[model samples]
Target chain A: MRLVQGNEAVVLGALAGGCNFYAGYPITPATEIMEQMARVLPARGGVFIQMEDELAALGAVIGAAWGGMRAMTATSGPGFSLMQEHIGYAAMTQTPCVIVDSQRVGPSTGQPTMPAQGDVMQARWGSHGDRPAIVVTASSVKDAYQMTQLSFEWADTYRLPVIVLLDAVLSHMRENVELPPAPPPFSRTLSPDVDVEKPFGNHPFVPFAETTRTIVTGLAHDETGATRGTVGHASEKIIRDAFNRLNHDYAAITQYREYRLEDAAWAVVSYGITARAARAAVDILRGEGMRVGLLELISLWPFPEPTVQSLARQVQGILMPELNLGQLILPLRAAVEGICPVAGLGRADGELFTPEEIANAMTSHSTHAERRVSHHA
Target chain B: MPKMGEDLHQYLRQQMMPTVWCPGCGHGNIARAIATALEHLGTDLGQVAILGGIGCSGRTPFYFNTNAMHTTHGRVLAFATGLKLANPRLTVITAMGDGDALAIGAGHFIHAARRNIDLTVILYNNSIYGMTGGQQAPTTPFNFRSTTSPFGNIEPTFDTVDLALAAGATYVARTTTFDFAEMPEYILGAIRHPGFAVVEILSQCPTYFGRLNKLGDPPDMLEYERNHTIVADEESVISRDELLGNLPVGVFRQEIRPEYTHQYADLCQARGGAYRA
Candidate 1:
């Protein structure tokens, strides 16, 4: 086990995951990822390019992915916003690539060095159009390494852009992490022969052979990657299939950890750095004989709705403590769907929530639940 | 039941016929020139990739039979750069318009030239944003009227050849849709060059630029362009101002410089790992 920063772990994770091309522009809190890539990727026979801006960074990553390389780019909030257009393009073209957005406080260039989970919703809905998003969050340095590797695997497996959302604190914080043995590089399965007339098959899910001459466009296209302007239902069918593929595999896609929920009456739902405090709060509340548990989310998008539904049945109330003002609570409340009461304890002033603050919110939620039950009775 | 030049079918996507270009638009001529250049060079269709931006010129990739990527507005060069670096064997080319290249995509154009990566850029200079109804573009001549400049354009125009040369492109050339005889030769030369090569084709947006400037019809515009151009030679002593209105149409720069991807390969070789292919 060696101590390393979360950004450094991301670099090691990307290399171990077989990332061969990294195109990025340096941004606060995410610059280390780019710097490490520049220092090491070339020596390892990979390509590391500092692009002109975030738009070009993601653009190049999509291009590299089409060139049959496992490519990635790292940036902060402002940069992530610049990449939304190409992110939509990557989704439409079904190019597998990883984008690591190390979160900083911002609507636009807000505290670059400070941590904020304001981009949680943006990660899912930043790009225009209704596209499937696979976003995973890491709360600790070890999780950063593991999740970064898993992000590449998921991107390659699903043929979509997977976001590894890291906040400023988790990105800069250092912790001891045991680096796992490098897994065999995961590559897209391609056919050996080429059908020149139909390079891409009838299904967008079906992987096209690199040997085949194919056209990949952002326009509404049929299975063969031909633009079908106001054509039949081919475009709609392909987009539906893309979303259905992920939705059907919810068991594999949804990832979360439940703590001390054997017979809990209330729970604290959180992710990223806030989960760290929520876990501590859960343990403290348990010591005080309060039935409070923690549901820590690792997979933020395609949100574990089923899991939340089940938890809502078991718990009377859920308190969501986030760094932003009630971003995660929207989905959490929707998942609960009036089955249970959900409250948010948010802080967007760039300070992380303390264990005591989360515990206090849980206590107040329990009191409010009791008062409401009595009044209803 | 095929046409006379059925062999050209190998390079085209026949299904996406009835191109959206206006009847007199010069983009068709530029596209034909590119097709003829590829045919002349005999490049492997499977190993070639055409990337295009959002404009009339951007749609050129959709007609090609090779691997094509119709990308975002003004960002095809960034994408092409990555593709070329990742697979140096692929012949990558980008098709963009004046507004796409000089206005929004100017940063990428300059940076790509500075890097000297091996790729070809075909800038279709229509002098107006034809895709968006002919707004004044960076290449629109001074005192010309566009939708945005109804009275007259106050800003000076950009000479793409000079821009490419200043950005350190190893090969820079200028041609026009009117110069149909020489367009393919210039495109072929640009494609054959090792480093970043740009061939700026002064195309006409007859529906927009022609109408706004009262330049008669497509034929009239072509005739005017032909008469205004001077064939640039090594000993040419024409001043920049003179060349602006009466354009100099020929290769302006060709130099031997270290290419980005090739140098990267050499670095990988020196480092002694499994990166070399």
Candidate 2:
């Protein structure tokens, strides 16, 4: 067990998760992840490459993973934006890997050093099409480590890319996070049975066929991984089958942690650094005789919707505390079916949400919702 | 160098005799140089993989008797990088032409060199696009007429050696089919170079580039190369204008840098695998 910054935690978590190859181009907030990997990966018997740009960095990682190695890359908004195309390729091919995006302000190269949650939507939709991911967010250094470790597990288990969504605040800020005893849940790899799954196999095993466990690219591919989109075999079922297999077994990989929600009238759902501030506010509100609970989202994509829905049923309203203009609020609202009042509290001014700010939002919103619910009752 | 004999011909024939490349094309010369280099190294043929991108140069993989992949245009380096990292023991080589490497694949080429990946890139620079007809290429000399540039090209040529060197390629060299005797030496040296190595071969596209530019026949193109090119000096630095109408063919730069795969493996080992992470 040890204390570490969120940046160091990502590197350590990647190492523990069996990511032996890291290729990246240094960018703000994400530079430390590359720096640490460059310094330690070589000494530890892994390879760290500082590529010329984000495209090659992602390409190299994709190639390394193809060669049967667990690989990863780190970047900020600009770099992550460049990596979307390759990320789409990874998702379509079911290549098990991890990408850490320590987000910052950006439409095109916004503030480099400042923290922003602007990439929440981009992370979900940055790639060209509807490619799903197993995304995890971290509120603290320890959460960064734990969530990243979980991200690798989900990535390997589902055979797709997993994103560890961090922000500038968590990426650069120093913290004392106790390290795990031994990196839990060793990363998975292709089984020897995968040998039967060839790119041009005339007959492929049906189980792995639908999963695309072997073929990892965007080209229209058959079970053997050969590209064939002609009329006879131009079945959309192939795409649906591949994605369905991925979507079919997502629940086993989803994870989250709930805090003080047993008999609460209001719920605060937060992730990454904002969750820390929300928790502080929750404590202050509890002292003020308000039943406020904290629901820290460990996994963002393949979102823990079932839990959020059940919790929303118990609460009169839910407040999504975030660092940007509230990207995850819509998902939370849609999942709960408008049963509870959902409010998005965010800031894009590159400042952490102070506890007082969250307390005011939570306290004020809960009070307003209580009066409305009582009048309707 | 070992005498080019019956065994080399047998290796070539095994990849299917009537090769896809046009008759008298310089890609054959480039393929010969690569085979000679590999043969000189006495490497286990199975441990070497030649990855190729689409173009006249891409077909070199079909005639090379090794683990070869005919990948999409301008993507050879990306796939080759993967193959190298997978085993690191496998000698990975990539072959591509001007448009393949310079135009659409420019991003990949520059980035591959910058990483100093332990892969050898054999760029066959034939000035014009032969497979797609004589369109202008990145290496097409300024004021040279082509199918696309009927009134002579206006854009400056991208010096292959200069681009590689600037992009941090550990080994950069320029050779030509006109200097066939030296081609094997450059190829072998590049293969043995410890880091990212790029060998730019000034190849002859007698079919398209010749007809469009009125260079006449295959032998005529070779004669032009022999007449125009100068052997570059190691210590000298010259501008593009100085080399205008004259290709400088020689070893350009050779340096050493840590390979991407090595550092990647080191990270793996640190993470408790065979290599450090």
Collision count for each candidate, in order: 0, 38
Q: Each candidate's root-mean-square deviation in Å?
A: 2.7, 5.9
lDDT of 1 by residue, A114-177 (tens): 9999988988999988788899999999888888888888887777899999999999999987
**TM-score between candidate 1 and the true structure:** 0.96
Give me the overall lDDT of model 2.
Answer: 0.76
Question: What does candidate 1's lDDT look like per residue over B38-96, in tens digits?
Answer: 88778788778989999899999988877888999999999998888778888888999
Error of 2 at A113 (Å): 3.0
Please report the interface RMSD of model 2 to 1 decimal: 7.1
| lDDT of model 1, residue B74 | 93
Clashing pairs in 1: none
lDDT string for model 2 (B45-91, tens) is 65666767778888776676565555556766876676576558777
Please identify model 2 stretches exceeding 4 Å from their true place: A180-193, A196-218, A228-242, A287-290, A363-377, B1-46, B51-86, B99-117, B126-136, B144-152, B165-189, B192-195, B202-244, B250-277
lDDT of 1: 0.86
- Model 1 chain B: worst 10 consecutive residues (lDDT sum): B1-10
